[model samples]
Target: MPLSSRLPILLACVVALGGCAGHPKGVMSPVAVSNKTGGSKVDMLVVTSRVPSDDPATLFTGERSPHPYLTDISVSIPSDSKRKAGTVQWPKKLPPNPDTDFAVTRVQQLKSVDQGRTWFRAHVVGGHALVFVHGFNNRYEDSVFRFAQIIHDSGAKVTPILFTWPSRASLFDYNYDKESTNYSRVAFEQTLRTLANDPNVKDITVMAHSMGTWLAMESLRQMAIRDGRVAPKIDNVILASPDIDVDVFARQWTEMGEKRPKFTIFVSQDDRALAASRFISGDVQRLGAINPADEPYRSKLEQAGITVIDLTKVKGGDSLNHGKFAESPQIVQLIGQRLVTGQTLTDSNVSLGQGVTAVIAGGV
Candidate 1:
């Protein structure tokens, strides 16, 4: 109950953001574009609700923008042999070697909806699009690079779109980041509506992690209330390490109407980031840290027809265990092949888990 007691919990979250010290934030260097080394490339369309920054490298700051901004970012990922799957190899310095680190190759600002449409025609394939919402404490470049790695490693053949909100990207600004989600909820809803209304988009998957999951769900809930149902074209939803309170998510799900997208959640009971989140959120359990086999949750998720994957036992990536969904090879591949592609993960597809336990709705 005391502030002193909460300090320790707050410090735990600092671990997630403390690692990137002394590095320049959001730098896009042309140097990486010259890389002839055999690596991979991922170009993504970005939509943001942060204030534009004067610094070109830091295109957007954590301050809420009056309107959304759009850009296209390209990141160069090292060769498969050089880097491990499911990890963003952050560059140590500017003008990074594309062969050794993830580097930004290009940054182009979009002035109008026509430009965004052009990008979709040029890059989107098979009428499939995957929109990614990054977690709290992420810079513009952080989301860009991380999503690039996910696309490159998972080998998902779809248009990649990133939706980023104002996150100070500091451990101390958790409340600000939480409020920012609410501020951007309408904008995010508009984004999904645009994608759903687009004639070129047939199948859509929305992948959101941590606090972004809260934003995603809220936006969808608003859409459900306004449009009578979530967009039919956006049929798959993946929530990874969601930082939302379990009880709150239940209410959100209820408001989403019967025509909601199929939901799949990646949970890890041992996630320390969520442990901190729980402390800040009045000691309520976060959706991402719930035990899929536990009481209430098990029966509730089953009745709701939601798939749950328990990643507590799965190892490797993010010592805090908050990013297993993206950091695990099997999990990322499953996301690309199953969830993102709109294929239901049935018992036959359980092999994709590799070793992580998966519980399909209706008790798999």
Candidate 2:
């Protein structure tokens, strides 16, 4: 089924599984799980919330406390090699607080650890650590699991860490979602700083999607300004389907200066959601939705030593524009593989061919 049509059904399934059990008022709702396999079980966390839909600015101005909704979750993955179904259940609601904590209820050891087709304890043995920032309307578990799948499928050896900010998860509250993105910036930076201080983590790569890109850039900017240098621990930054204003992003990039990472951006001219973003921001020129065929922003980003991947022609899902990274297996593989190896893709890896392409002329 088309992803657009499939979204409602998937959401209904998530709700019907009773994952919202014991949800606190004015906080995030819980996720429901339906396990087809009655095998070993483990606990996870879920959060849900509600907000006004029409305006994007409302998200930031709301008086809502910045407290994360916590829950105890149980997940059951099939034990049989042939079975591939499982369910996740959220059992209790947690109090609102600035500090969040998780106590693993139970864990089931996987029989085999092939790609992310199965679940296992996430451990970073030797590779770099990757921190993923999800776009608007994403729950903690959804982001983590999706990224885990990508990381595993790409055969990346790095530990995957999800930096989940609070999301209302309602289509109606576009403004509220934007506000939450802004509110989470400080917290996101704290997490990065903490990770940078860790001895076990050798290098870090940040993958921020949609509005999450704003948070990532802001956090990085803060880190750089504070230390007077880009945190050497961080290696790369990936922005996929960023929803920021092109002018705003340009200013941000300019401020970043030499502190920037080996940056990569995935843009598509066909992204419809970005069209809406352009209307909302009233900007005729935008970077996130640039047409690779025209290569308008490619030159600028390349000059900044940022790699641009134009996936406008890559075909796969109905939500093609919205979920190119997660839905497209090839894109996922490329990101996972490169991130795992800590390889910085340059013009050579992209094969610009003969004359100077916009990406090459721009500087990348």
How does each model score on lDDT? 0.86, 0.56
Error of 1 at 272 (Å): 0.5
RMSD of 2: 11.1
As a whole number from 0 to 100, the lDDT of residue 283 in candidate 2 is 50
Off by over 4 Å in 1: 3-5, 12-24, 352-354
Q: For model 1, how does the per-residue alpha-carbon lDDT over 120-180 read when each residue is reduced to its tens digit?
A: 9889789899999999888877888889988887889899999999999888788899999
Top lDDT: which candidate number?
1
lDDT digits (tens) for residues 85-177 of candidate 2: 221222234422211211122322222213121221245446477778888666444554455445544556666666666665554456777
Off by over 4 Å in 2: 1-122, 292-296, 346-364
Question: Against the true structure, what is each candidate's TM-score?
Answer: 0.95, 0.67
